[model samples]
Target: MTTPLQPRNTAMFYFQAWISFATAMTAMGIGIAYLPVSAWVRGFIGLGALFLVTSSFTLAKVIRDRQETETMVNRVDQARLEKLLSDHDVFRPETV
Candidate 1:
């Protein structure tokens, strides 16, 4: 069976996603740096921000993986259905 062409991703979508992630991390880092807090507090905030960034990336990857898996399953199901239908005989006389 022939597979359909996937849709093309525009540069704008990538640009926007990158800018948003960068902006969030930058804002958090700057905020942690300038806050008048103790060393431990600053360290905690920095660590938390780092964790957030890492988790966000991980979450995005997981979601993308799940979507790809689902798409593959759907395609497989479609192909199976098409094959079954093609192999079926419609005009054969049925025995009661």
Candidate 2:
């Protein structure tokens, strides 16, 4: 037996990855251009950099999670196939 692919789950992951990557890029741009001597401007820059760093970390985690999930799915498929083969004795030893 073969398992059908889950498009919705795959789409959700892609959406999350895109949003996180875009957010990181936006934050990095703000941090770079908003530097100033004024305390408020400095604060904004600091917050922007913080956002960029956090988003990057989140993106990395998400990617790792996706990889893990895919690996688990493959293992499950392999297990199912093994069970089917065992049930039917697809491979038999030579007659004695």
Candidate 3:
């Protein structure tokens, strides 16, 4: 009984996750950029920056795909239910 709302929920959930990650990454970037840090530390910060960008992109794509898939499924379910309900003709009342 998965509805279209389910995928939307999932997409929102992932989006939230990405926002949290972005905040953490920005914090890390600020810490590395402003602090009197060593070369090794700066290198690590650069790597973290790369990781953050890639991770955010991947998460966004996944969310989009999931939402699209769910919408299709929901549309199909609605059509099927509509057809079934229409097929039943309950207008004739029989005398028992």
lDDT of each: 0.91, 0.78, 0.81
* Number of the candidate with higher TM-score, 1 or 3: 1
- Predicted structure 1: lDDT: 0.91
Tens-digit lDDT track of model 2 for 47-83: 8677767897899899989998998998898998889
Better by TM-score, candidate 3 or 2: 3
Ranking by TM-score: 1, 3, 2
Measured against the true structure, the TM-scores of the candidates, in listed sequence, are: 0.82, 0.53, 0.54
Off by over 4 Å in 3: 1-34, 92-96
Where is model 1 poorest over a 10-residue stretch in terms of lDDT? Answer: 48-57
Weakest 10 consecutive residues of candidate 2 by summed lDDT: 1-10
- Candidate 2 similarity to native, TM-score: 0.53
Candidate with more favorable, higher lDDT: 2 or 3:
3
lDDT (tens digit, per residue) of candidate 3 on 1-96:
344434235788989988998797888777778868788889887897888789979998999899989978978989899888887668967669
> How many pairs collide in each candidate, listed in order?
0, 0, 0
